[model samples]
Target: MADHLPPVAREPAAESGTADEPGVPRPATGDSGLRRTGARGASGPRQAYAAIDLGTNNCRLLIARPAGDSFVVIDAFSRVVRLGEGLAQSGRLSDAAMDRALAALQICADKLRRRNVHLARSVATEACRRASNGAEFIERVRRETGIALNVISAQEEARLAVLGCHILLEQGEGPAVIFDIGGGSTELVLIESGPAVPRILDWQSVPWGVVSLSETCGPEGADATQRAARYQRMRSLVDEAFAPFAERIAPARADPPTAESLRLLGTSGTVTTLASLHLDLPSYDRSAVDGVIVPATAMRAIASRLSGLSLAERREVPCIGRERADLVVAGCAILESILDIWPADRLGVADRGIREGILRSLMATGLRRDGAGALRTGQDAV
Candidate 1:
């Protein structure tokens, strides 16, 4: 873990921003950094907690102060770096990809420092897990950015994703499933949870995310026929990967899920992006999408429509620009597969996940003490 950050480096928005606006990923501001109105929990001064998540598709950071049962976010940053761009074939983190990720990490480090973060945890996901040079890259990050990153296991990844989003699960009596369709992998967590919070009953991580699936199928330049065929093929692959999990949950599936008995929650670019489309927003709005529930049929329609579009046509979609156009269909494939297995009426979207999980862990355990600092930022008089 120490080797992952050699001490170094590290976006956006048109949104008013907060938990509701995790969507609009801004480009790294570079020298401009980010100007934010500092915030903190009313707990006098336990200082602030920070979390950084470096995924194959994006790098994000969140700083907050524990507020009663949860934390109030003071600042946040996210950028789509596509860190695992070519790893599917190369089995390595490409030079260009590493450069992009390193730059993002640097920005996160600065935010952490400037915020006077009392406790911070950073983690890297599937891309790093699969890269042959992943360890080396993490070490370099630590040295260059002065931030340490933990490359977590699939199980831990599933757990954290659940920890981050389960609070948003719909109130119900039966079991629920929360999944994250990421860049290089997808995690599905099945839990027999109710109002208090869903507990992880079982979970699965498939090595197919929007980035990896698109890479595997190469749908960018294909004609409509080819793109549709490729999208189905991607779905087929995800279905196969998900088979075991589906089988394992057969007992739970005995009665099937209804809107009231079972719920589906999703945390990832795929779900959030799809939610934005479902609402037909002029631009991505986290508040509009986050914790919002959409009909499963509506989500599938968006996915199918997107699959039939040309790469150029996709770039014209509101929330999806050139940055996400190519990867959206693959995400659709993963999401559709999830909907199929679970057969739920509605799908819930959560913009918060790993970062929130990390913050909860730190604050809950006193792993990082509180009352040591007063302000959310370094400014003395906040």
Candidate 2:
């Protein structure tokens, strides 16, 4: 959501080039490593770590320095590269999509170079994981941008997402369902959160993200009557995908929490967009939207109204620009399906996720060496 960041997935480091899972190994680092800012007249090296998430729909980077207990942002960048634009049917990434993604990675490479990031990790999600030439594209990125992008599994993606954004879960003992509606796939994690990072008791990765769904389902209908039929079809598609997951978790938590204890948290473009519209923001404001809780009924109303509108009409809405108008409705469809499965009264919105998880994982070691004991708590200026 623009330059504004979520109170990031307040989790830890991740790894790539080493494991199929997201781990905390150096991502964009050269042999030189990060500069210990003694050269800058600071007591310790102004070491920083970078995490890039090359999702099907967006390319996001987060650079930060360790704070006392957590980390603080230094510099960040994100772009709508639409890497999975047509992968649903083609089973291969288009040249245009790869080019857009490569261009964005180059920008990230430049930032990591300028910041002298010590340890970093970059990951590719559903788009790359699904593409036939995904490996070739990763090699090209390495040669051109010098950023090794690891195409992680849906399970790893789900784990990292939860690792990054679980902090936003409402404080209740009852199991909370945290979902990340991504571009090509949606990750739903059932968590038993404790004092520390949330535990993933079970998780599911449904292959119905905005990009893939729109490509398959087509338009949101031209009029209200058609729109209703289209919406039901979309809902049914998602519902079927979710049915297996529902059965698996159904009996696990046989004694479900009451309305007061259950929490539904969503971290994705769809949820944020709906929250922004519900708040009547002329434009997206991460500060106002991140970690904000909105009533499920309000979000349902917003999605219904959006479902009834045509593509051109959706483009008229403030944040639903040309790039997102078509896909946002698909996202709404996914959100509505989730709401039906987990009837939480209020939904918590998270702006942070994958990147934040990487930072937290890497910082587990970086924090010990950050030397900026004073700078540990805040590095927003860096």
Candidate 3:
């Protein structure tokens, strides 16, 4: 199945940070007193917002409330359904994949309803962009689940990805390279520094992603050398596609103007799963993984380890279960190639992405403000 998660029960405490104990929900920042007080016409018990990402491999949901300068996560869900499993070979959306995605969307709708989310945005990524019958499937979702899904463009995808991972830009003399490896495509954006705003100097969306690569070039009963060569060939393709973008950002590399250094910030299934594996955790742990840096060498080492394993052996790795074992290597190859093209001391890991970007944009706009001076839109709100 294409990676999609059908909606499930809301767990408020898991995101709030107070529910550190197993099975308890975390205390969300919405309950914290740190929310900005100056927004105009804003009055409320507290505004609840939601963001949903329907990707090629998974469907994810995150609900949150504004906290200080940043917001705190309140509730979250993610499921892998492989919505783009055969999109590379078939131009049309597969009925089976749509069913999986639609089911997941229903769950998201239920969660949004249960959370009483006042403002929300849900986006469909590469799979939806490429499928010939993608629109029809979207209409079906709205009719069946009462959820509106926006099929975002690749450019918008890169922009939202930046918004989600901008925190990394603040840490160093940064002209950071940000990329997301999705199920059907990969987005790479190179941000160059300005005194006031960092500009995206170059961006590209490569059609090859985990889903496509796995389907197109996966081992599939091949000999060991053949599989290795296929992996290498895929990596070379990614490298070739990335060349133009790299050259465009070449000037920034020679003389990074900012005090903060240029680094890579990755937001995708591949990097996050790798982070989980790095910690050797059975399940994903945001605290242990997010914001951590994996050196380029270490990342290659991890990929090397996985490349050597058989499918079953790869599944034995903590972060990559059977569901992802087949595609993980493809993802790793893409990441490794990107990093090798522009060697960075550290590659930042972000569990957050487009969803967080949407919420940040919404609250900043006071779209959910219920009273005067309560949640007035910020100047930065787009």
lDDT sort, best first: 2, 1, 3
Q: Clash totals for all models, in order?
A: 33, 17, 38
State the weakest 10-residue window (summed lDDT) of model 2.
16-25
What are the per-residue Cα lDDT tens digits for candidate 3 across 288-373?
Answer: 66666766667778887787677888888876778888998899899988876567766777766777777776676664345444
Candidate with better TM-score, 2 vs 3 = 2
Q: Residues 264-308, candidate 2, lDDT per residue (tens digit)?
A: 889998998888888888888766777788888899989989988
lDDT (0-100) at residue 7 of candidate 2? 44
Off by over 4 Å in 2: 1-45, 252-254, 368-382
lDDT of 1 by residue, 1-382 (tens): 0011111100122222233234501212222111112344433355676788899999998888766677677878898888999899999999999999999888887877677776666788999999999999988997898767778878878887887887777766667788998999999988876445456788899999988998988645457777777887998999999999999987786555344466788999888888888888899876567678788889999999998999889899999988888899899999999988888878888878888877777666443433554423222210
lDDT (CA) per prediction: 0.77, 0.77, 0.71
Measured on C-alpha atoms, candidate 1 has an lDDT of: 0.77
The total of clashing pairs for model 2 equals: 17
TM-score for candidate 3, please give it.
0.83
Q: Which ten-residue region of model 3 has the weakest summed lDDT?
A: 1-10
